[model samples]
Target: MASDDEDECGYFYDDEDADEDGVAAFEDDAAPPPERRADYTGFRGGGIGAGIAADRLCGLRIFVCTPNPSSFQIRKGGRCYAGSAAITQESLYTAQKQDLSTVMNLLNIKQHQARALLIHHRWKIDGICDCFDRKGRERMLRDAGIVLQENNSLASGGSRIPVGSAKCNVCFEELPLNSVSTMDCGHCFCNDCWTEHFNTSVKSGKKQIQCMEVKCPAICDEGTVRCLLFGKYPEMAKRFDRFLLESYLEDNDSVKWCPSAPHCGRAIRVGAGERYCEVECPCGFSFCFNCAAQAHSPCPCIIWDKWNAKNTDSENIKWILNNTKSCPKCFKPIEKDGGCNLVRCKCGQYLCYLCGGPTGQEHTWSSIAGHSCNRFKEETAGKSLDTKRQQLQRYTHYCDRFKIHGGSYKVEMEKMGPAVAQRVRLLESDLNLPFAMRDGDWLTRAHRRLLVSRQVLSRSYAFAFYMFGGELRTRPADQATLGVAKNLFEDQQERLEHHVEHLSKVLNAGAPAVHQVENLSKVPVAHVPAMPEAEVVRMKQETVTLAKTVETLCGEMYKCIQDELLPLLVEPMSIAAYRPDGPDKAKELAA
Candidate 1:
């Protein structure tokens, strides 16, 4: 198996001067000290803020224009040996290329000092030439020997190409029918190989996908994933393409955005205006942009995935400028406000649907996605105080619902608190008083506990179900929530009967004054007639007091929740299991 794995060295860095450790081929003796190296100011203000990596100087063939004292002898086997400073890639390129001997010609670096800085440029810098061409360049970059694929494959972990240069998955051949990229897990079989695999999975009803590379979390690029595989691997390709087409038609134009929120996620979304439907997320967090819930449409946002992907643009700014009026990819309305006219798609696709133009393939939405028309309804929506007021009203509504839920639960639980306390007190009073030590105390204590449990649960249940109007909003009186409330009500009825039974003998005989069961309800007790209006009003007042007691108990529990339980919910998110920062937050609510 180890023999099957490819060597770290590749064609690109296999040159005569190419050192085994890529660093040795590129060290320069005469260079600036680390303290004087230039500070990183983010790549040309393009938003890709990358710092200069110090290790790079040792990896290239360095050339110095002038000699200086900063220059040091190369370390030969840990000892400094004088080696004349080189003036070109050719001289240093020869002495210690592709061997441990180059590292032996170590920089005259001090024990604690950082290595000297030589000429450095990012990959985009022009006129930078390598001894190897493009293909060779990619291959050399692969030899760093560490791959970050999630699935730990027995293979080279998807960082390196498959054994024997990865034949097409379908045809089992080396050359691809067209352009292709290996999965992150280094499963580099041709696209044809994967199309069949997708067909099998999708058919078996698997909705999620990751690399075939063991446990990789990396998702296949959905758009061309099928095309690449099917275009070459005929059998699986045809079946998979059919599935893809079906998916495309039923789908509204969805754009892929990053799932990371206003962060890196560029998921696929669809629709027009403040409401978008059927958003497909690249991070697998598909949900509606409107209502911020899961996507289920006929009622989708209808976003164009190709429109929002221009996360960083240099070459495609003009295309975005031309397509900013309406969405360029779908010819649908784009209602963004106050930005340059760049509208990148969530998917990789980038063409203007409005003028049949193309958007900047990689630009910020603000760069070119300026509002082009006077037609966005959501725009000028708050121009009227009434609309603004309504927006405020909705915000308040959601907040009020949440608060009412908490309050109602607390209030209900407080009612049981006093009952439980009184029962315990009554039991204690009777124990020390001129009365027999009753076994009934055990049953009373249990009843009190049972009451406390019911009180706590009943209120929270009501808040979860009824208070939010989730029950009212649901059809059939919101069966899911209603069922819970109904069950709680029934449980309370049963508990009342049970406690009454335990106190029955004492009630008929008349219990001791210290622990009387006189006023308590019992099944075997005599029947009572309906109360008059005044009596009903009095009863309602009693109910209110009982509710206050319940509320107090609820507050006590909430204190515990807030002080201890909630902190454990995690950071950047509450409850640790829900909300915006949570992984499933996008899918948690219904849109």
Candidate 2:
């Protein structure tokens, strides 16, 4: 913490913050006119002009700005600063000197409100619209009073007195004596319980992790969650530490283009990842970061003894480059643009350029008279599309948002998570809904997984569509699409059918009749654990044989689409139809 006098200026801020509150909104569609800017100019040490009430500001980050290089000087407490970017104030005063971007975040207010507070206060805030502008003053007043305060209802706490020992809210197990720790929910579950809660939350595989509280809108604090969960379960502890790695990548929307063709010639670059896990390049070129393709020409290791040695010696470099074929008589270089390896000398002698053998026209080697170009071309065809070619080029680029796979789970989640989460909450919260499923955390997670399952199934169908009846682009008619979709569903049926056989074998694997029990709690433990076997079998069946997995659901969905939706589209599509398997046809559908 800086002293009050120092905070009147500037300070170094850390990157742990997501900067969600009042940071500048990310601009995707527009870039505002630069010349329309207003001036923001001032960074100084000043006495606290007015006090801001805690409740007045929800998020605010303040920065004093100055355009001047070295003109103004302030020495109320005998301190010298180089520039506003360098300014530092001590204590609460230090925060007082933060950048406007920071100020907005700290206060959690819109620009208008921040301006309003500055005007109403009539403080020496440089960024404020000056001369007591009424609009600005009102905004400042609202912003200053907008404190971030919330009352979360999901209580978590240990048993205090009469209700026996504290139990784990998560696994429903008993908490260890004297070691119970409470979460922000104030519901005290044991360390193990909360650790599992966090692990399941992260592994439940959500883009934005939230508390277990139903309909509660609090974004759990990292510091609090970390303090509450560490040391109980080491696996969760390790993962929580790893989750912070996102901080190093400060911003999203970062991307690098493929270096190819019109630009730097098909080169690839990435800040990290090596290659795709599943797909391969069409060019038969594969590479990771450290080493992609082999070097074409070896470097000269020996040093020159004199100045004449400094000359480039293009002929030597050409030799290094392996320009094997040359005019035998003229001694000039010859490059074959398209054809094979046999060459005719300028002096009319014929020879095989690749093997330096004799050509058929009276030009002969020691034992053989002629060599054919056809065999040479055949031998080198694979190298034309080889992993490396000295003449052809390639390039690559790095961007955080640019994904290796055209299909990306990371990208899909950002678009889908919020909608899914909201839908789940709505399902759980609504009282009128007749769904029999439990309206609780685990159920919500299971629903989320179902969404992912459905999406993958759809993608697999698309892949099958491309593979079986040619591309969808060629045959997009309802009939053709359904024809391809049938195979996809069949493929899934085969997989799940296999699983059904596997689980059935488990039943007959000498476990006996004890495995068929319905309620394990109702049955004596000495008798056997019956319900777990059934539950496990049920889970597997639901994922596949029970007809809930993506493959089966996709088949049903495609059937519905064909039977219901296709009929509606068919007439209009016929009216607007163009030639099949053409770009114009694609345009009409898109339009």
Candidate 3:
């Protein structure tokens, strides 16, 4: 802990041991925003300032009116620090060992037994504890296919094995004691049979290989499995080892493999009860820990899934299915223009519009020649077309806005990000300016605000599509309540959108040009131009103010989402809570 005097003096130093609550030091390259503490006040209705709680503040170095602060307080937000850790390939064994150790020490059980318990409980320590409390130790262990022995020798199958000779239950052949092994369940099987069974299980992608004896509920010892297989099949033994190691990620609820393509070979583990939060891996890939999708907050996974599917190929297929009939001869989609049972395809094939079958060119209103169809089918098709058209229109409206903001976000991230960084370098490199005036944290914070706010604005459209749309099965009685909620949501969303654009404009308009030292070689040093001090001050203040405002507006939008809108749904769904710093970065666990 830092002394009070040190904190008051703004004594900043780089410390790898720094925690989420510790003051963060920035670097030249793009990095995850450091964790900060913020206090949440209950949602209050008023102007933007009234709703601006500490919880909504970004994790940037917030310099309100000056670069230096006399004193400050850090308050933790509920969603800011999700206590997640990044597990890389290097640290995978260490992490798995830690979890195994916890269970082993807690229950005084062997490593394999602990592993069985953890895998069965999905690697949730609290769940194991809860089951232990509810079912007691004996029953819980039994249920997880763990049979505890009084001593190591008993558990090792030494007592049950005969000194002379034993028959292998699997092969039904007489085998020497040296050639056979007994499992913890007292089921003895020949090495050949055991190896083949393990080989089959491993080839079939079974992680937990159980005893070969029928009706035996015990998990085979991992060490024994390895010993039996390593001599004949070294690669399969290695694979078996890999499976047990990877089980920490595959079986655990809180941990997930980073969803990066070309596989980052890293998994993230979040704190208990925080699987719903978003996290960033050390590999620079950010994702929602809950759904393993791109870091999309304010948009629930279900809505995002629906939106993605709708945008890609589903809508096009739907439009064809709903509005067009396939030509019977060419099998191409053909639209009906007007007043005809017989429709001509561009492929020179004639088809019945109502029945979508081949027909002669001559046709009456009631029937096409050689193609009689149900007249009532026209009513059903008409009604279906109307419904599909309305759905397509609504989807297009929301999707356009979603894509627009998303496109803007890409531009800002790729283009604006470099511009901001260059300006920061230009400002900080100026030896003529005062140290306090040269700090570019305000600009960085504002730009981050723009990027995050744009994301919120974009995803909110997806949320609105599902929330008030027909995807949710709402009752007629709830219609009035939903209307009021929709209006409120749209109001907040509109406010956020306005400020986000304003911030973007401010950032783009104010992006400083890098004063190149190389260009100065051609010109006299005295002729060099400099930005006025007053303008710099004004730019700082304006950017900071807008960043704070956008931060607050984002909070209110999320508040509206959680408090006003989501509860009205028939089926329960939840979104990851908004974090002003974006997703929490998963700390790399040491090997």
How do all models score by TM-score? Answer: 0.20, 0.22, 0.65
Q: Model 1 lDDT vs. the true structure?
A: 0.31
Ten contiguous residues with the weakest lDDT in model 3: 37-46
Better of 2 and 3 by lDDT: 3
Give residue 357's lDDT in candidate 3 (0 to 100): 69
Off by over 4 Å in 2: 1-193, 203-208, 246-251, 255-331, 334-591
Candidate 2 steric clashes? 65
C-alpha lDDT (0 to 100) for residue 110 of candidate 2: 29
Q: Model 1, residue 432: what's the lDDT?
A: 38
Model 3 TM-score relative to the real fold: 0.65
Error of 2 at 395 (Å): 18
Q: What lDDT does candidate 2 reach at residue 471?
A: 20
Error of 3 at 98 (Å): 3.0
- Relative to the unseen true structure, what is the C-alpha lDDT of residue 467 in candidate 3, on a scale of 0 to 100? 83
Write the residue-wise lDDT of candidate 2 on 30-119 in tens digits.
222222111211122122211222111112222222233122122122212111111111111222222223333323332223322433
Clash count, candidate 1: 85
Candidate 1 local lDDT, 206-314, one digit each (tens) = 4234556555444443333444444554455445434433332222122233334564323332321113333334345445444344432211121112112221343
Which 10 residues in a row give candidate 2 its minimum summed lDDT?
582-591
List runs of model 1 lying over 4 Å from the truth.
1-166, 177-179, 210-550, 553-591
